[model samples]
Target: MFQKVEYSGTKAQQYETLLFQVKALTDGEPNLIANLANASSLLNQFLNDINWVGFYLKDGDKDELVLGPFHGLPACVRIPFHKGVCGKAANTKTTQRIANVHEFPGHIACDAASNSEIVIPLISNGELIGVLDIDSPKFERFDDEDQHFLEKLVNILENTIN
Candidate 1:
């Protein structure tokens, strides 16, 4: 049996709580895939107005991202570096928050209902590991605060992954 947590307080506060949950979840996990899978599940449970949540892991031998565990409709399995939101985040080592996926140049439509998106680059020890991607059906669903907290969440991920 498990206890359900009701996320309360300001958006930032709720996000902080989520971060703590992430740390707790990955505290001693050394398996990368398991951690990423759980992280995506946590995001799907915590977030609203979203159509997709998942990871795009960097394929070390290739210049591309391979889809990891996800919670949503089927998605593009591989994204070339710099090709789309996930790719841009991987290529630039920066977060990509798109207010309107339709307007973004070369946007990849994994789910046609996703209007907005945010991608956080996952780097461990100065090496690019992958990215955490979240999508929303409504435009501008992600704000600056969301980006800040999600980045912090990724920070926790970078440290926990082996």
Candidate 2:
């Protein structure tokens, strides 16, 4: 069982706590879907000013990302590689931290209320597994610190999911 997250610490400390919580939540779980579901749920509970948190898994033998477990309103079902923010991150295998979704070309409007976004590519053993995506209602909601911590979170997921 997961405990309520306490946001009473420095940003880095909070993320460190979140990282451990995620590790604890998914530890020994061999089911990928269950891990992803709980991972999204954890992010939804720990983060603030965010409207969406989810995963976009790479379809086997395909160049598109299929939606996976998520905690938010309905989202775009399929995102081709190199298409949107998620796709861009998938293609580059790098984190995309957009301050303004409206200004990003080819940005998919899954939720009109989402003003900023972050997408982290999940890589394990040099293979692209998927992406961890989050959206916020405020512009410039994500920054370098967020990117760093999320990358760490993704690292934990990669080690445990498979």
Candidate 3:
């Protein structure tokens, strides 16, 4: 049984709380997939306004991102390096936060409802491994606070997933 975890605070505060929950959930877990699943679930539950919250795992050859754990509508299963937002983050090994999806170059409209997005690359052993992708229907939904919190959350994910 999946119990809904309620967050009580401003959007940023709620996300922070969720991040901590995810960190705690993944801490000391030896299995990478279980950690990723919990991380994805936390993101999907806490980020109420988001349309997508998930991960794209590095492929067998380490050249591309293949769909992994996620909680939302269906997403792209495979993304080539530098192809779209998720790909760009993986290719560059950096985070990309776009206020408006329409303004981004080469944006892939997996769900036309997504107006904003944030993609954080996951690195392990100094090599690009995957990306945590979040999308929202509201423009400019994610701010600097969100960036920081997500980065911290990704750090936890990096340590656990690897």
- The lDDT leader among the candidates is 2
For candidate 3, write residues 27-95 as lDDT tens digits: 789787888888888788777689888889999786789999998789888898868889889888989
lDDT of 1 by residue, 10-129 (tens): 888899889888898899989889888888988998998999999989898787999998999999999999698899999999999999999999999988899999999999888889
How does candidate 3 score on lDDT?
A: 0.87
RMSD values, in order shown: 1.1, 1.2, 1.6
- Candidate 3, superposed: residue stretches over 4 Å from native: 10-12
Model 2: per-residue lDDT, tens digit, 58-159?
A: 999799999999999999999999798999999999899999999999999999999999999988788888999999999999989999999999888898
Query: Per-residue lDDT for 107 in model 2?
Result: 96
Q: Sorted by TM-score, highest first, which candidate order results?
A: 1, 2, 3
| Candidate 2, pairs of clashing residues | none
Q: Residue 95, candidate 1: how far off, in angstroms?
A: 0.3
TM-score of each: 0.96, 0.95, 0.92
